[model samples]
Target: MKKIIVVAGLLLTMGFHASAEGYQVNLQSTKQAGMAHVGAALKLGAESMHFNPAGLSFMKENISLSAGASAVFTDLEYSKDGYKHNSDNPIGTPFYLYAGFKIYDNLAAGVSVNTPYGSSIDWGVNWAGSRLVQDITLKSFSIQPTISYRPFEKLSLGAGLMFMYGNFSLSRVLIPAGDLESLRPFAAAVPSLGQTLDNFKDIDAASATLSGDAGVKVGFNIGAMYDITDKITVGVSYRSKVKMRVPEGHAEMNYANETELKQMIATVNPLLIAYKKNPIVIPPLDKGTFSAELPLPSNLNVAVSYQATDRLLLSGEVQFVGWSAYKALNVQFSQEVLNGYSINAPKNYENTRIYRLGGQFAATERLDLRLGAYLDESPVPGEFLNPETPSMNKMGLSTGLSFRPLERLSVDLAFTYVTGFGRDGSYPYVSNDQVKAFGGHYDVKALNPSFGISYAF
Candidate 1:
């Protein structure tokens, strides 16, 4: 039972990578998505709160509002030992809303609501890797209240308070049908137990479901921006790490041969004691609860943008993710129910960086064209990769356009394609005091389409 809780924590964290490289989502703004999410140095009116809040003070209008959403479709394939399986991932819709007000000549205030992390992936229950993970889903949202100030003509600073909420559920096979033969020795010692085991020896009979809610957590986002010249700007932003904690979670067990399993356990207990081995304890699922904690690593972004010509603008940025903070995962179960068993699993994730470049051209009086690309490094090591999150280095290409039919209203559309480099990896874990490993080749790809509308006056 303790092992189940430990594995559940891993699945919950790993499951977050369905939409991005790690537990992150960058679909905060349609305009920025078209530019590979690079807007740290650009003054994007109300939509700048997520990228760099300092840009808000540079808005030219008294009021600005933007709302957008993206549909993410992902495909993942796995192959090992001539066996193949594919992930049935549902379409993920990440959306954002922002409203900014110019309070004074040098002051701006705004609020943003968005889905920064979430995922859903399902591999059939009978798959080869069912013992590791069968299905998982995670959902999260954050609300930020931000303020920006221009202390000087060329320098602006900003800050925001982030309130975040998240929840997850996952299922996995507890025991595989192929491993039942290992218990034949004990079964042989008890005649009735042997008959019960032989009756359904090849059936995948046991599984578990773990679900939890991460209560509200608080964090902050801060940023600074400076005008290097009339046509050049530079900016830096930092988003603090938020620790998501599940105080009490639910776990349930299912057995295909419940009556037979109970009978076998009762029959085998005396034989095991005769051999001086510990007896199996039935899991107390009806009243048991679990607790866990996972950090939503911090990130820093530095960017520069140049207005080269009257109709052309170019921007670039480098993002440093502090994934090293996630050194391990810990889960604790209630002592009253399970003897207070706890497990601390080491992850040893390393920090990574992302590179982005984008450009926008004012094609006509009412149209703007944009193109961008980015390269994201995988944070998970090859040896620790698992089926739940087959993370690999990836490249993304994007294109978009904005159309203005009315003077104060603009419509936006953007599309992005992401492809991961094929890789083979393995995940090793301990089961019943024995080390076991699961390995395979994985390939992944995703397509994203976004639409939005912004109005400023």
Candidate 2:
């Protein structure tokens, strides 16, 4: 049928842009009251373009906007001793939008649209680890354009440019038997009639698919504030590290009953080519085109702040993430019968450090209150836990509230919580007589919630 509709439109254009390893879902946005205070204001405003665009040079005088949403919950488990499985995923819905503006007098600008990363898992295909993975969904979105500058009075600088979008889906199944392919024998082998066969061969595919490519990222932020008198005031900021690239697409491989396995490999390729003329490793029904490559790693932030009165405020922060440049997964096949099948996916991912503390209280003149805490560390390790991406080590909690009622109008709310402490890995399967099956060990847990709102003109 037109070659199965042009191979299903090239597997939907190879799903668009591939670059997924697993465990990513931060959602970005909801620091209402700056998570209690620690955000310290990288210059403060336009949501500081996601935490620091020199805080948009402390934008003032008309122009500001914000919106938010978040919800994520996950709990996955796999066991042995008679086999048992569990999965619960649903609570994902991240939404956001931001805007800020100010021109001349020191310049300032902003823009944002978020959903940092995403995830979803579904398991149970008859258990027994179902080959290791049953279902997985991923998403990433970002849009940032910012600028800030303040020549004097205490320094301030900012810049940004980010545009990203991603999506993915997965599924699996493969089986082979028949006495392991009749113990490979065509003539020599007669030890009283060697025997062992059960007859079996089934290879199903499609766990996830979708890809699109794009790249060009950059970030910078620097801030300083000092007034060690008149009641003391000090602040510092530095944020940089953003490099992303995702290019390559087009993939389609749908073969199951593909015309009765292409007429049983054209009747067993001329009877195995006259009983072994060497030119038949079980071939037939071969189609092509496949590609994938993704790398977007970099992060660093440091902060410290103190107001201590006039409504109270205090903050602290430190964050760094490099993720060992994500190990491997370079697969490019256009027929060579699957040349050099690469899929290492091991970088032992590390380079992680996160700590934050906050507090803010106004309680009058219009009301305001906030509180925060965080500690996250886990660059996936535990034998490279896999199920697409199952990471661990996390703890966070935050609360916020703000209101002005009028005077340009203002209202904001925030909430956050994350927890995950479970680990174990190993999942690799490849069979078609090319034998290779190893799938066992798994456990995971996660949760998140956030909200936001702001307006001034």
RMSD per candidate (Å) reads 3.2, 15.9
39 in model 1: Cα distance from truth in Å?
0.8
What tens-digit string does per-residue lDDT give for candidate 2 at 28-82?
A: 6665424622453434477767666766676785578877776666666666555
Pairing residues by index, what is the TM-score of model 2?
A: 0.33
Clash totals for all models, in order? 0, 19
- Candidate 1 has an lDDT of 0.83
Question: Cα lDDT of all candidates, in order?
Answer: 0.83, 0.53
Model 2 lDDT, full chain set: 0.53
lDDT by residue (71-183, candidate 1, tens digit) is 99998899988888898888999999999999999999999999988888887676777777878888889999999999999999999999999998877766655444545
